[model samples]
Target: MQLIEQNYARMRETATRDLTAAYLDRAMAELRGELTPRKPEEKALTWYDPDQTVGFWARRMSLEAVAHRVDAELAAGEPVMPIPADLAVDGIDEILVTFLAFASRQWPEDFGDGLAGADGRAVSISVGTDRRLVRPAASGVEVSRDDSTAEASISGAPQDVLLWLWGRGDGAGLTFDGDPELVKRLRYLLKEATQ
Candidate 1:
């Protein structure tokens, strides 16, 4: 806990209002430098990046920055702005694709038990007009853009869906279709994977 406290303190100290622009510029430069050496077709190993590619990291980081900006604003008691629908869609995709996949790999035992009830069952997720169908795979989950008749479906606006998927929202505004018990089970699995 001491190490965590020290790191938290260090972050607090460095979190200055005046240096925000400079910090962002420097961070972008570093990220660009890291991406510059990669071939167009190459897939890089990334812990939290989506799709194992530089492009995915760039997109994911952009969304992350916007989310963190909301967090900072909320901390300062300012009104929050909505994230763009497209960006929120991408954020949801990153969680479903990159984050969950990495989590399953890191903690296989947790997922094996967590996802068992929902295994081989397809769950369709809809955010506005965007949609994805996902089913359990041996490794984690597999996603496809095409719609299918799923065992359960969750539908909501992009922002609400993104917030719900990230555990920031309670899914109160989302609609659940098909079997209620199956939806509950899938929600549990998603929460466990994210945690």
Candidate 2:
């Protein structure tokens, strides 16, 4: 758990730092007339205000990058790198617990209730410590957990699973079993993130 947490933290920090530097470079270019700033009325805008802090964006980007890195490593058929269990727990807590909790709360009330009968469905996540429970939302999508005792299991190298959770489709190297519908729904959630 500790190793997962440490790696996650390191990945997050590295991603944030790299992205910040890139943003800074672009902003500097705009200031020097090498690039043009978007008009205030532009319908599409990418850059944030230079004076405004972008911690939220940084965190999101960090997680996305780290998740993909895990995927890439796994796809290469390399040995699964172990992360601190605590860090893995923290990543799950932030992305699944905290972030997804907010998403569930903020989701439009009219949004069609997720998969039918998904509420009582059991899921187990075993990236580090084991977690087991019914799907959090009516939405069918969910993270994978330990299958040794789970009714339906989704197992893979941590990185592949993380990438799949984050919605990366290139998970040919990963393994999954049972509840194909649930897996599809989970994949959909990841796809939504890309949009």
Candidate 3:
């Protein structure tokens, strides 16, 4: 579904405002009473149940709001605020362990080559208190936190890093001190998938 695109220049200006309402309206319209069985053994899911519906929409709206707010902050040339540690951790868990895991199984090619191979390695990704280790089953891409001992470190404001991950920022002012190829590949994959 097409989500509303806001052109807010800064999230600091909008943080107190509620963006969830607009997302809820859209989600309700799109998923109303829809019950598409995801697996043969399980029953279909629907929005008719208040609890189920609210839970689903809450996650969706939260991510949507957080992502856009990050964008707004970036556009305004301000440091991106730390997504509350709890929220960030939950989001990372759901996206990597739940959403992307399923997507990878269903559409392996989307994750790239090493993700489908046996020698593939997992990389640990952490943002603030949020952390996860994901390996491409066939792809050889490896992501890990830079060892504090590295002579040089790749660094940027956390917000820029988050925006880069979300495929939103230009990455112009970001720093890269490690494997340039890996960084390039990561950026390429994000861009490719979003496109």
Assess every candidate by TM-score: 0.68, 0.48, 0.50
Candidate 2 backbone clash number: 15
> Number of backbone collisions per candidate, in order?
0, 15, 14
Every model: Cα RMSD to truth: 7.4, 10.3, 8.6
Off by over 4 Å in 2: 1-61, 64-89, 108-117, 132-150, 190-195
- lDDT tens readout by residue for model 3, 42-99: 4334332323444555455556667777766666677766665456555555444444
lDDT of 2 by residue, 1-195 (tens): 223234344433344457754754564344334213433334432233321233333334445445654654456554445543444454554455433434444552323444443553545544534453325456433444434344455555554555455565366656666676666654543344333
lDDT of residue 163 for candidate 2: 48
Model 1 lDDT tens row, 52-114: 766655565566665566565557666546777767887898888766656665666777565
Instruction: Give me the displacement of residue 41 in model 1, in angstroms.
Output: 6.9
TM-score for candidate 3, please give it.
0.50
* Candidate ordering by TM-score (highest first): 1, 3, 2
Better of 1 and 2 by TM-score: 1
